[model samples]
Target: MTNHQETIKQLIEQIGILSRKQEAFKYEIFELKNKLDQLQSSIDASDNVEKATLDQTDYVVKSEPIASGHREWIDSNVHDEATIKQPSFQHHKNQNSKVTHNTPQKSKKLSPFRKSNLEKFIGENLLNKMGILILVIGIGIGAKYSIENELISPLTRIVLGYLSAIGLLGFGIKLKKKYESYSAVLVSGAIVILYFITFFAYSFYELVPQTVAFAMMVLFTVFTIVASLNYNRQIIAHLGLVGAYAVPFLLSNDSGRVEVLFSYIAIINIGILIIAFKKYWKPLYYSAFGLTWLIYLSWFVMDYSNDSHFMLALSFLLLFYLTFYLTFLAYKLVKKEGFAATDIVMLLMNSFIFYGLGYAILNDNAIGEDYLGLFTLGNAVIHFIVAAIIYKKQLSDKKLFYLATALVLAFISIAIPVQLDGNWVTLLWTAQAALLFWLGTSKKISIYEKLSYPLIALAFISLIHDWSYNYDSYYHLEDNLITPLLNTSFLTSILFTTAIGFIVFLQRKGDFISSLKEGSTWLKIVSYAVPILFVFSLYYSFRLEIEAYWNQLFSLSELENKSISDYVVTVNDYSLRDFKIVWVINYTLLFLGVIGYLNYKKIKNIVLENSILVLTIISVVVFLTQGLYALSELRDAYIEPSIYYNRGSFYLIIRYISFAFLGFSILSLYRYIKKDDIHKGFKIAYDIILHITIVWVVSSELIHWLDLAGARDSYKLGLSILWGCLFFPFNRFRYFKE
Candidate 1:
């Protein structure tokens, strides 16, 4: 009897272990099914390539999960984003539209990795450590002396600096040749010592102008000459060694008053020649000038602008800058064989970035108020010299452009106040709006490339400060809302700019909506939304008044007198209630629509797209409801909460909904784009959303399970994000996987 009982107990234990194994297997199978669903979705997305447009899958840069960076281009105001489908010219013809759609190619191709010698050395991580060590030790001595007596002779200073640099460079060569190239970093210390000496000398002693210019020429010439002497890597290493010393010498002339800044120019041209002749010097020597030009002008502007009061001196300097930049650019423009539409855009953008830099630098009044006057004259003079180059395109355009842009701005900044009799800040946005439309129609440029952010920024600023604040500050529903309505009209007009930009680009390409088979769903949607967001105020004119009144009352004067205040208070209360009802109504309707759509799907596998979309709508509902609740507190009972109207949240309803929707949408669309591959799209989109949700919860701190300071409690709700990930694999087998 005892033996039989023991046998039964052992058998039971074995069965229990097997049962546990079975359950574990089931769990893994569920997870794997979810993964498979996601994989299927990716496959579907690939099948739906409209043209190789955003199919630049490599550019998606998977460095880290995006909380925000450049990728947050899907926001409402992202006018420059690739939101429209530019079809082929053939499609334009097929559409037979009466409009002359002449959209230029979309984006410029980034230059390939053309590594110069400097890049090679950096990439190889050559002799870095040794270079750093030598540099540091040299610095210690200089600092010691600087602290001790604060005095060092020019000749002694030069000698010590050179010795430190040579020592570091020599050690770098030895270590790098025998062991690892990274050893050269030791020379970083020596380079530091080199900079210290040159900096102190330049800062304190105003070396005679002739001597300084002569020294700069000599330094530039010597480094290039030295690099030319040897093709050996060590010799070239020595080339970079002195180039570091010569780097600071470039800045010695920044009084900006150098009417003949030609001395440095002459020296750099000579250095460039030496580099061209000397194979080894080409990279290292070129690097010195490259480093100087990239940073020197921008950095030295403050110093020179502060010192130079002479307008002609500044004018001459700008002349030289524009002259050289154009000469180099002109050579490339002429010589670079075939000119594609893309190449033209690149050339234009490069010129624009440089030209517009003057706008930012104009903020410097240290150069005196007449700097603009000087810039205008000097800029026009250069354009005349280069008119032949731009003549084919009626390129008499440079001066024409500069003068027109500046003068129009003058009308905005100066003439407007006088014209309006100083009572109102005239709406410059209308002019911007008008210009945007005309430019889009006239200029044969692509939307993604041609649309400039500055105009959009101006419109948004007006939306925030001018329209919103004007209503709240002065006019009210109680007083009059015509002022606010007018502002909204202007605001809507300006926001229509992106669409106009799109239309213009489409007209330019002549193939606007031809790629329907491959265009992005989101882009199509935003195309519709931009117009709506632009005219949002028009849709709810009364609501805008409610908003303006509530904001002004809450912020400025709460209930003031009895009768008037009571009426204001009453209007505000009604508005806040509407805000909450709007949230519930919008979200509930959205939820029902999604469910109904999902139920109508012929198969469960196809439901990923709808499911993700519904979740997004729901998330927005939660986010905005909370927002309306917060805003309701701003004013007394009379003021309504402006949930989506005005007020800011880093994790606001729109942002949360947009991201959640986008992530899921992309995943879902990708998985189920193909009928047979439906399950895959849903799975991938679902999994990623889960991943996204988890990340949002943790990073955003949306949940309040843990105490948070400020609005950080937004993350407390983030815990719900796991729904995205969990649902994908758990219900995998049910997805359409044909």
Candidate 2:
């Protein structure tokens, strides 16, 4: 029993030791479980923190777990009333990390104003619309107050105006920062107000010294341009331009301070030009163009007595026009849009303005009219140089190049007429037509071709003018035909005729008629009339030559005393025996007929052939009858008295030879027409003309034979009887048979 008891004691000891060891292991397991729970809670809180950052809302810091003993300490120390306000160590550490991550985000959210959609809408859309209206109203109110009140001192008004402008400017700056859309209007309004204030201060009230006023005006202009560039606004530029131009007019007490006004304009335009280089504000440029020109025109029309106004006007005109030109150029460059029709039109307008202003300035300055040509020439040279520059730059725009060329040509055209008088002008015009024709046809340049027509017309008109009215200086009654033929007027006529003929030839060669095939009938008629005009000019030139020769040969001094009309009428003689003019006309008709027939054969033109045939027949009959009358006159002058005395053998020989030649010509023409395939109407007309010529030749020969046989009295009676008998047979057999 004692042994069993001792063993029991050992077992009890062993049980106590095992129980203690189990208790220690249980505490460790409990601690590990607590650690696992704390780790899981931290992971969940981390997920929540990530979700909170994404949502941009609440964040929580998870507390760490502690042992039971430490828990009691923490609960007592951290959760006590006084210590609860203070963060626990772990809580403080987590809170600092959370703040470090979120501080930047919070600051970013608060940096800008959180404007509502409605506020944004009003700021962007409504401000500019209302701003312009308010600006106009403000200007009207200011102007009305200044004009009507007279109560406020000028200095007070000036100060008030400046303050108002400054206020607007500051307001614009504030709006620019907060609401960008309203800034442009506010700033532009300020500029306009400032300009008007400066004008009133300087001109109307003398509130500021002249120098100070000028400086203020310049400052305002600069500010305006700056605002225009910044806001890309044209309204500011327009307002500033108007103020600049109107200042002079508004302040004009009739004491034309012309230089001062122009100086102000020049300075303002310089600012505008600087702005234009950066922005393409068309309204600004257009306003400047109109206002500047209008002011200058007003000054010109009023005839300001100040001699200095002329130079100032000229300088300002150039400045205003060039500034606008540069503005257009800038627009083209910035937009990358190619040259447009409007650009060409603007160029042309600038040219015209330059011309008008130049003329006015030169005329006002008492520059001689002769110098006007020099001015025009200089203008042309400037255009040529510009064209050269454009070409050298290789712009590669055909229309622009053509426009520049056209301008150069136009200026040249004007300059020529201005520089030259009389035939020199006509010669130059004719040459211009030739050059245009060549360019149009050979170069295939349609513009030049169209230009040729007008130039040709001008040349013809000038030629006619020279023929009719420009003869007095170059012509004298005592001058021979050679002198008149060699005169400038005559030479110009010849040149014009030759140039027209060549142009027509080129037109035919180039098939230009196909383009006109669909033209109106009047156009076709005009085409036919061109050849007729050529013929008429030749006829007139020949007639003048013949008349001059006749006056010289006949020693008809009285012919010099007669007017051109009376002389031409009285000198109309178709007598082959009296002068060579009738023979010359016959030869000319033959030459034209041959040419027309050849052309018809080559080109198959029926109108040409028919016209030539008709003209040839008519000319033969008219001249033949006139020759008969001329023979009668010669018989009376040198044959009739001699015949009475029985010495008219010379007249007999001459008359027979003329009749024989007429018979031969009639026979030849009849044979040619009958064989050739001509128009039916022309054929009938030619047959009749040939029969009449036959009868006239035969009857005249019969009468001459009767007169030579000493039956002179019977000659007249026999001639009439014979003509009566032959006319019936000739017409019945030749014309009626056909």
Candidate 3:
């Protein structure tokens, strides 16, 4: 009974182990089926050109149970990710075995690795291009040889060319499916040959009517385009376009029929535009754009006339511009693709080229130049509409959207200068610049902020032009009749100043600035150079205004009909010069005083602090050199005022006031330099400079006054008295004691 029980227990244990083996085998079968399914999918994608088969009779699966200890080793190896060999399956193939395996071998031509890159290039691209080129050259040589030998009539020659082209086309179409790339080369050659045949038939042989020849060539162009579309080849379309664009020039009779030429080019471009919308062939689109404009520009430069071709040229220019504009945006608006860098460049070129050509056309005509600004504004409106449409549609092409928005603003900014004259351009440009900056900061758009820079620069350029125009002695005497501060030029300068300063102010918000690297050149410009420009513009404008007022005052006094002010008096020209200089000096003092106040207020701007120190140094130098001389001249003139024009106390009071303001400006600088945060070394140097500058200015003023009162010969005595008076103040200071 015990022996029988042991036998039954061993049988049960064996059964349990066999059951686990069965589960493991089932899992292996599941994995094998999944791999087969994936292989089938790959074959389907390749059009089943390579077949794979798994025959039951060829592959034999065999399994054997392992001892428990060996199974334990296998399990441990699997956990350690070790490679363990399992039972093998035998695959066999024989005539009587009823099993066959098939995996189609890849052809050498189909496998790219079979050939080196040089061999492939020599076999594929170079050979095709060179062979076609050689064939075309051969045809030309043969035709020329035959013509020279009189072996064929012109009609026969033309007929032979057409037949050759037809034969090539037939061969290309036949071989297209099997040899698509070669077919493309053949088709391109055939199209070129057809174009030559058509041109010779019409222009050289006169064997065909012009209309018929044109229609035939157009048909040929259409066929080439269709073939390329079907074959998905851009090279064919490129060759076809080249042939199409060549037709007009090839058929040229020198009749100068630009209208017909432009019309034909327009038709060609329209087809290209259609292709752009249909396909993402950027090269084709750009070629069409470039070729169409090139043809138009060439004709305009070589043969265009204003009176004869003005309206016709205008129509065609607008048509071509609109076509390219639409085509450039087609991929974005229709296909919803983002703008590549080249796309943005082409778009910009299209716009500006059109504007420039249009401007030339308008400027050449009588009434058009007057409305050139309007034309520019019209362009701005068109782009604005485009931007609006893009925004409304909410297209995801952010680059294109930003570009469109920038274009609208750019056009508007440009139109100001193109349409308006003089200071009006500057004024409007500044306004636009401010608007762009505000939009940039508020909308968090960096492009707008960058664009604002150029507009502001343009405004500044325009402002300078106005200044030159207004202050030009020759021009001012004739054209400048407006008031000083209230004129358009001054207004333009103020607007420009405000706009740029506001841009600087907005930059302080750090919204637009953080996008820049901390120590970039542009950051330095905005931080340092921009503030200096502001101060310079302010100071220069005020100086010009003061000079302009005196100029207007004198010029109007000379005019009997013009009364600029109630106190217009005739004075010595020398006195007038001195008065102008004195007024400017006082204004400078006031300007410097205001700047010092800004520094004293602790604006915490490095540029401001440096500007004040630099300006103080400059002022000290000028006071010692030019300023003292000018002051003495004024005082001399004041002592000897013209009896006819006693422009009395204003001049004297201004001189004294200038001295007072100068002292105050220096004191402000001294206080700013003495601040605890300032470097002790900088403070010491600045204190010495300011003390010497103030003492020299005060003693000079007193000595000059005493000299004017007939103490000129006692100049040494005056110096001694002045030093004695200043010595008491210096002795009280701790630096003097040290």
Best by TM-score: 3
| After superposition, candidate 1 runs with Cα above 4 Å error | 1-262, 270-295, 298-313, 337-361, 366-444, 447-461, 476-511, 514-517, 520-525, 531-537, 540-542, 545-738
lDDT (Cα, tens digit) per residue for candidate 3, span 169-221: 89988997556678888888888889988887898779998778878988988
> Which has the better TM-score: candidate 1, or candidate 3?
3
lDDT of 1 by residue, 1-738 (tens): 454455556666555445445534444443444344334434655664343442343242232111211122223213332243332222234344433548564445543455454675666555454445554765767656754785865556556666866786567556743343444344434444555555544554443244664464355435434433322234444444455435445445554434444444445544553343332232443344344344436544544444453344345345445544443333333322223454344434434444445534554665444355444444444544454455445332233333334333433433233233211332454355446544544552223122323444444454455545555445344454444345544455344444444543443354444222337784465445444343343323345444554454443322333465465332223444434444343444344344334534632522334554545545544533553344333222223334324433422343344335334433343334444644555556555555545454444333322323334455434446645555576468347543
Error of 2 at 345 (Å): 2.5
Select the stronger candidate by TM-score from 1 and 2: 2
Cα RMSD (Å) per model?
30.3, 23.3, 15.5
Tens-place lDDT digits, model 2, residues 636-731: 445345311233455445565565555544544554477557556766676667666767767766765665566778877787788788768766
Write down the worst ten-residue block by lDDT for model 3. Answer: 60-69
Descending-TM-score candidate ranking = 3, 2, 1
lDDT of each: 0.43, 0.62, 0.73
Question: What total of clashing residue pairs does each candidate reach?
Answer: 65, 0, 1
Better of 2 and 3 by TM-score: 3
